[model samples]
Target chain A: MSEVDVVRSSSMADEHVIEQAPQSGTGELDALAAALRDGQPSAVEGIYDEYGGLVYTIALRFLDSPERAEELVQEVFLAMWERRASFDPMRGTLKSWLCTMVRSRALDMLRADRRRPRPAYSLDSADGDRPAMEIPDPSRASDPAAVVETRAVLSALDILPDDQRETIELMYLAGLSHSELSGVLGIPLGTVKGRVRLAFAKLRQHLGIHLEVES
Target chain B: MTTCAEWEEEYLESLAAGSGPSLEVLAHMESCPQCHLLLQKDRQIHDALKEGVRVVPPPAALKSRVLSSIQTSPSAPQLHVMTEGSSPARSSRQLHRGSILIARLAAAAVILLASGISAVNLARSSSVTNAAVALQLPGEPVTYGIVQVHPASGIAYLANASLPAPTPIEGHASEYELWYIPSGGVPIPKGALVEGPDGQWHGAVRYPVQGSGLIAITVEPAPGTMKPTSLPIAAARV
Candidate 1:
């Protein structure tokens, strides 16, 4: 199921969605998550098949080596399996949670290697050298909803004001917080917040999802 | 009073910060679908952006590596870290014992447990072993340690180590490696032992050690080696 569909099921249509678990991409993700929580071996295979490319792309772009990236992917999934009980789908989508895990562990790995020079780049993030939107991701070909969601995000990001876009990239891609972005971009924290809010608002509009909070 | 608008503004800031919604915002969100939807869309956008990344298919070996890792590497050997269960500190004389006593008494007990007939023949074999064994430096032993073999995994953990921590010397040999040497035969490399906070070695070997050989430890290079280049500093036959 596409991220857009996940968004709609969990947040768009129902006001009571907050009280229930956030559903993602048919009940398959939910089933996978339940299996994972129960420490089933099949869950690892399912999760890897679904999210391995995403994990590898993020790890590869950060670690800059295919071997280390591969190791990191293995580490991430194994860790997720070991600590499956901690995962709560009510908190967020599995993809985003895995993104967070990949980023965190990759950064930890980089930090632990004191002999190596500190990475001045994001640990796990989207491949930035190419316009990812333009590239048709073969992995997501089976799920058109995912494809459209990817395109919409990239397209919305393209239309954002340069300042706002830069702010979001620093915060999201660089894994910087509001204060860090403010410090890096030489702006006040409020300005950092302003740019993110404006960028996200415009993104929501462009992606055809509007909420009262955005106003 | 914090208005819903104020709570909503904080909620947006927290989401953009990549921090999850605060309890205040969550409480607000429980009553506010608008803010909840905002959170959902924000997450969807992030995931979508990540999905847009160029898919670099991982190496085919990664599947085997991940799967075999679970099969081979058990959870950290927390329960096996110490064997003595309060084995008293040995005096210097005991540390210098001229001979190795295999767990013969325990083996005899094991035999006697099978009724009186089996105990006599098994006492002299020196083949029966127990969970705990002493690893000692040969010939008027200096510092000694204990090796606790977890029967299920054959992974050893050190206890009451009077031996100094394995030092990284000459930038080549950094860790203490465990080896299993059969009687009058070549030493098979087990794996490196990691030093715990208490300065004793802690590690598990993936090898299927049968306890039919002498388990020995030698300081070797970091990440360990296939064979030992130096004589073992401490030896114990299980």
Candidate 2:
């Protein structure tokens, strides 16, 4: 069904509630887009809630500076707010869009910084002498209920062949495109797509889950 | 044309979007029980993930900082209704015209270069055997470093004698890729390498910048390839 049809057919109450809720995936993205276009503040909040971590994680990974990461996060949200009108649902989902923006900005910062010589610290050098901070295994659980679910997802991810997992992480977490993935992974584009496909299939089989696509 | 796997992946991608699949994928999905069942399960997993992915509240100061930055920054081009104001529209048109004039001037210069006898001199002067000649990063402070250029072979070597090994991600490996952005072309992929086991890495890439003038290094996933998927960790103009 067309987006207009979905928006119109859904009851007003349902639409309003969906607008307020943090979007999980693309449906929430569409709803968020609609809300932002309508100038709804709640939609902005929903977007932040849904993608703030992803953005923060990416920024932190690249910047290695928490302060810079936080700064980039704020910049991303501002960019999102300003560019809301330009977001076209046809091109890609909001998550992908947000990620693209975050990555571009981060890259710009990185390139800019390369000219300046900054003091460097290597985490690897800290080695045994340093106190070991509890490394949060994103795969490990902290709580029973939510942790179990997270673990299941991680387990499913773990079962994927190495190539597939690596590709998925680079594409989803690291924001690499198919061509970029091929470049980073040193594999053919066809191989990248194949690995992604197999990865998705394995995730589905292991988790017994299917992703829904909005027509 | 869609294989079951493609259809399934597309369907899942759509679900991630919080919607149903494309008409083509969905049609196949409707007729195919395996795919249909897969779709149902995908929805459930997505719903479960919604709850599992906790939304960390943004820092309170971020809003104020963002708003302040926007306010302090130069105003972007403002769209004015024909009835609201004439000044903005006039200014906008003038800006557009100015840009066009500048572009025309640039094009004319290029044409002149192509047609003029000076073009030979230009070509000769521009021809640098080592396109990988190390140049400082534009607008950045220059640090003491050595950029080795093998102009004849089109190879550039970047060595940071005092550079430190990049810190690894908590749970993942980290590596670097080199990029050579040609003077007027797309950035070309060089190769990927990590700092030596002792916190230093020195490497060379087959330079694609035959006539180009820049070299850059970007942190990337291990097993690097031709193009960069991530941002440059360091860059210098060659």
Candidate 3:
């Protein structure tokens, strides 16, 4: 069999928290990658069965459109199937790696279109009044764990200082870099970094989950 | 470049930048556990946040399209396995010795460094400890660590511990495996505890925990066994 992990994360309302837990183990990842590399039957399908939904969800969120997300899903899987030899579970979980690639690719698409994804709800702007993010998938809110984890992250972001909140929203959701964020926000690079540091510090203390949102 | 205290600002700067640790910083982290923990924490936090935004489930057609698309795509060239009839992951493992070596060296260095600090602390405490909470260590507990997990998230951690390897091996990094004892279910081996710079073990389980369960720890050699070879030295009933 491939690999699966036994990592379960709950809200900080209980014990500590885990971010994204991979569904498979290192040996499992290695096996999956190897099988895909050798073009074994159902190997690609097996991967899709595991993480297809996750990949599509991330693509949709970043690309802000279903058509693009669909296209991205196919593109990403094909690339992984072809580049299977390069995947090393030792680097990180297949989940983490896929998430990173999908986000980066979606951002690349956004940049090519010269557009940016609008947040569902603006966490920072003065009015702080904006339309919420629309996820056409009503079934998404069905999973209790996913709901809790999503709420926890949003809640953490909600509590950050407006500046800090905005800093991460743009950096994370938009995949903007420190320098890019500085230019867009018209703030100094040091100031941008300060907000990121303070925001993550709060995230670690408040939710026990966090990281720098970089492109 | 210099002292950890000196590296602190540079570390955070790079961390926030998402540029990853530089060679100098990594070289420094080779000796510092705090920096190492910070790095893992940073990545986990980022991963969690990224995961948060991706809660939407995919449509059925997406999976169908992906499945069918592969039918038309070119297949990977079939190559003979170097060793006859080895497993898939094992075959790949044999193919990329360089990558495996680099990863092993990095992990070993981190765990070795972590054992010096976090493991030492656990050895001294032997009691439940951590910002979250510690798992109970049975059988007189040598260098047992704390465990903190979210109920449904399958997010478990062996916060701090350093114990001698059960194997007769010498001077090698010690790896303790975590197990999910689902109430009365069969013991499932999760993964080996990889020590962060802070000397705590960090990793995830494959799926979510449904009801009551117990997470325990056992020391197993590499490649892994179907079951736990030794009784648990660390355990926490949830």
Candidate 4:
């Protein structure tokens, strides 16, 4: 047909080969990370193929909107490319770091959305002066068994009492520190510490995990 | 001795973050198998959660968008220069509005003075006689609409169409400092401008022109003082 169509056809052929290649390995992620650090163009495709689903899922979890989640996924990768130089291998694995980045971006988007006009008072404003309150979404709580199992580690948090669960979700999922949570939840400092401790203990029990306490 | 509960919380946080404890904590855990077992379980849980998390691919168009944005965006040096004067600042009003026009007129004046025959006395009497010649700061690209310098007047203008607005420096009695950084040179302090009660400010500084450079702004304690303790609010090159 035309030159544009020719180029598109060629690219489609190339993508077909890439898609057919094994897509479930960490090797691809490590390679993509290396390529991105080295500023290679092909790394973008590799990264998208490997991590797009995870990033999109995390964004969808927080925003609950496909369009917004898609937009954020793009923004997250764009940021990754822009700030690739700052990626430190020593800090943690690239995947963990990427997860942290995606989560932070999603949380930021959530906060911005809360600031926009809404019919009801935002949970954020209600808990602004208190330690953060975790409002469990019944829908997410009642997810399919597979989805629950997939997120089973998080379910250990469900073993916690409501107050402890509130503290743990605020600290873990929302990335708030103890002091900030105290402010948002309007709880005494001691109470916050107690709840966090109890929550960790319950999580440890539910997950059959043990934590070494340092003297 | 660290309490079981206190250490437990820290351990959980560390595992969630995929980081090991300090050497001291590690040594303790080594001597205490009970704690070591706990740490192992935590790691297992963390790993499982990580595996369960799905990896999402970036959109098909992201690569092109990122590549094009980087290519079309002005170079960093130019951006740095532009941010200096681009703030909706009122203090540098004179400098921002007519910096280029002044530079052109000054260059023309310098040329006429250099040609010499008829206007030596006229040039000598001109107030703009000591105008500084704009020097391109080191490490800056020679890009147009990025930085303009007028040495005679000791003014550097930056084109900052892309820089974001400075966060509102709320409250009373606050000052912001501007620095002119030459290539490979230390930042030279340009004086301070005050922000009004409405958290708005506008002004320019008259510092001894050291070299052609980028402009940087930092918020500081009041009275238009010299040294800057806070991070720069905005920056641009001239």
Candidate 5:
């Protein structure tokens, strides 16, 4: 079946919510961005207070090191401060732009670590000291909507078949390129791409109306 | 010509994969409102997926550290100073002060160079023929020993460290081995390692490692295997 045909066959988009593009900020975020352009130290604190957790979270998930994640957060904010003039509020929201910056830096860090050979998951050699993945407390999130979105996203992930979920997470969260995903999963490149498409389809199905809702 | 539906799927996939749209797709989005709406819908998916990753608040000190760094940095935006002009007389006075500052900076650089030379001489006394590169261990910081690779001597020296000795698997003896990993090439086993005096590990291996290669310590069921059996305990670039 054609790709659109398949999408239509699922009957998922019938209930899809059409989310509006996050409008450029005219208020606090704009002032913060303007202040950052002028190298205002207070502006650094403002942006950090708003997005520090999200930046740190992406780094931690990709690198799995608290120290490295913290360092990356600092680096991202500093880069944003230095390149504040490049930010165009008309193109996208500050939050989306910041997320892109975090992903770029995190992916660069991962590549610098080199292509890892798959570790032997032997019982005797497994690292027992590895830290558990941190779970966010909605109560502590920046807003109530964030809490609901977090819960909803997590629920969507839980419903995915194991293989598809693993591939999707490695591709998106771990910052693995399609080529890297092929090598890591020991699957052909076509298969890796297929798995990703299938995973996204399922996410669209499960997250239909919820995905459309702006947090 | 590709259908809008196909272009939309490709656009959504690229964004969710943390990549921007291609030039052709961007052109299409610009002229087509339907495609532009598709782009917004893609953003929604991207944002939703991002939330699936758990958030960990950064260390409380990080904010202050960033602020202090930008405040003191030489290249930090002088936008305020440039935007608010001063009188020509005041500017001339500032220019005079800048000259004095440049002279002082030159003197400081000379002193720093002298200190660096002395440190290099001190390192030369030991077999460490080159500057030491610290290996980054994931998870907790290295608590016990430090790992450094000396390219000049073709040796990786492990100082009094706390790496756990390998445990033998059933019917096979296991040992930690060192390998030279070249950029974009298979790993070449350097040699088998034995704990040296004071629980250190050192070895001279015969691998022609490139400038951008890595030295890794891996556990193997037996030495001389072409491939490693376990993940590296530590690794540093040459």
Candidate 6:
């Protein structure tokens, strides 16, 4: 069966924001790559159908405009198809690679657009320019327990000390590297790293994971 | 680079920063099971955060536009070429029509780089009649063809035997779109090309593209798009 056909026949659920499986299984990605190499038109639709929301979410988190986010989504997937030959499954999962690509490209777009840097706010910005903080509906989780667990995790994140929370948002959601965070936040690299460590420890404690937080 | 206890803090900090691990940490983790498990746990948390964010569906117009762009782009078989080679772009500074230089450069042959052609210094002789460069698609022998440009006229002509018929967009025809990608600027669409039976597409631009500009071609859905939906099949700096 064609890759598109197999995707259609599979039991993969479309509604959940928190995917149970890693984004785009290796098998599915392999098939998509092959289809792209063969010039199959269906691959484009198939990929978008599968990961379009995730791509859009990442873009929206970074760019802050649904219109610009939409444009990045289109550009990213098209670039994926164009650069299909460059994808290496052994190196990483397709989803992670896609996220990294989207982040880099969005950052590039942001740099190109170069708006005035808004004054840093202690709370989430009033301009609606904060990186993503809204949580997906917990009910969208696969099971009732999963839903509750998901809510707990988000609540844990929400209640984190403001500094730690901001650090997390800047690093993960804004796709900032350590050096970039230091420069942007006007904090020392060590301080930025310390904040992230404290944030992760708090998150793990809230989620009930027993992982150690090294001092 | 530091003791295990110190490395542990450094490792978690790096992960939180979205930069995975440094080589020193990587080497250390390979030898230490505890560090490996910590790395795994860190990664799991990172993945959850990434996946748990709210989902936003793309606007209705995006999917059809993306589909239309991909359908009309160059066939994928051409990209099967290995991405290792000395970039033809490095030598492109000498590109000229009937220049005989392409042959000598092709023989100088240190290495072959991957896909994406870079065009440099493409010009017509003193006559200023026709300034053209070659478009290189991915292939073992490097599929290439002539691209004619009139910087003053803001017109470009593409003639390549390897060029395929434009892929048709849903509910619309297809056309080849030429774009000039300026350094540090977003790609600006020059105009659309209508393929003749002989497999050539040409168009006039709204503005002049200056020297050493990058050019690219993508087959886009018709009622031609203001932005490109597919990656350029060919990219060259001219």
Each prediction's Cα RMSD?
19.7, 21.6, 22.5, 20.7, 22.1, 17.3
Superior candidate under DockQ, 3 versus 4 = 3
Model 1 residue pairs with clashes: none
Over 4 Å off, model 6: A1-25, A115-198, A202-215, B1-54, B74-238
Q: What proportion of the true contacts does each candidate reproduce? A: 0.29, 0.10, 0.25, 0.18, 0.28, 0.30
- Candidate 3, residue B66: CA error in Å? 0.9
TM-score of chain B of 6: 0.39
Q: Can you give the DockQ of every candidate in the order shown? A: 0.12, 0.07, 0.12, 0.08, 0.13, 0.17
For residues B159-188, what per-residue lDDT tens digits would candidate 4 score against the true structure?
A: 221222233343434444556545455555
Which pairs of residues clash in candidate 5, taking residues 3 or more apart in a chain or in different chains? Answer: B145-B161
Q: How much lDDT does candidate 1 score? A: 0.52
Q: What does the lDDT read for residue A10 in candidate 5?
A: 16
The CA lDDT of each predicted structure is 0.52, 0.48, 0.51, 0.44, 0.52, 0.52
Candidate 5 lDDT tens digits, A39-85: 67678777777777656666655555554555567667767877877
lDDT of candidate model 2 versus the reference: 0.48
Q: What tens digits encode model 4's per-residue C-alpha lDDT throughout A1-215?
A: 00101011111111100112234566666777888788664576566655665565456545544445555665676677678778776555565555677767776776865842111112332324421112333357554443443345554544556566555544544334555556556677667777765665556677552222210
Off by over 4 Å in 2: A1-58, A61-65, A77-97, A108-147, A155-196, A202-215, B20-51, B76-238
lDDT of 2 by residue, A1-215 (tens): 10101011111011000112333775766788888766554576676666766666555545544445556776787677677778876765676677777767877888876832111111221234421111224455454444454446544654666456545654644344665556545678667767766766676667653232211
Error of 2 at A19 (Å): 15
Best by DockQ: 6
Per-model TM-score on C-alpha atoms: 0.35, 0.36, 0.36, 0.33, 0.37, 0.40
Judged by TM-score relative to the true structure, which candidate is superior, 2 or 5? Answer: 5
Name the docking class for model 2.
incorrect
Q: Write the per-residue lDDT of candidate 1 for residues B1-238, one digit (tens) a residue.
A: 2565455557666765557778867887777776666666766776665454334555543454454334324442222211221223332332233012123322322333233221111111332122323333335345534433333334333444455655654544356766655544555655555544456544433334454545556665455544454455555434
**Tens-digit lDDT track of model 3 for A48-111:** 8667766775675456555456668876886777667687755555655666677678778788
Which has the greatest TM-score?
Answer: 6
Q: What digit string (tens of lDDT, one per residue) describes model 6 on residues B84-191? A: 123222223322321342232222111111221333233332211222333433342334444433443333334432455565544455656666655555556555
Give the alpha carbon lDDT tens digit for every residue of B1-238 in model 2. Answer: 5578777666655654455668988899889987777665655555544433322233433333333222222231211112212332233444454335433433332332343221111122221211121222224432322333434334444433234444443334445556556556555555544243344345454454357544555543344333343444344444
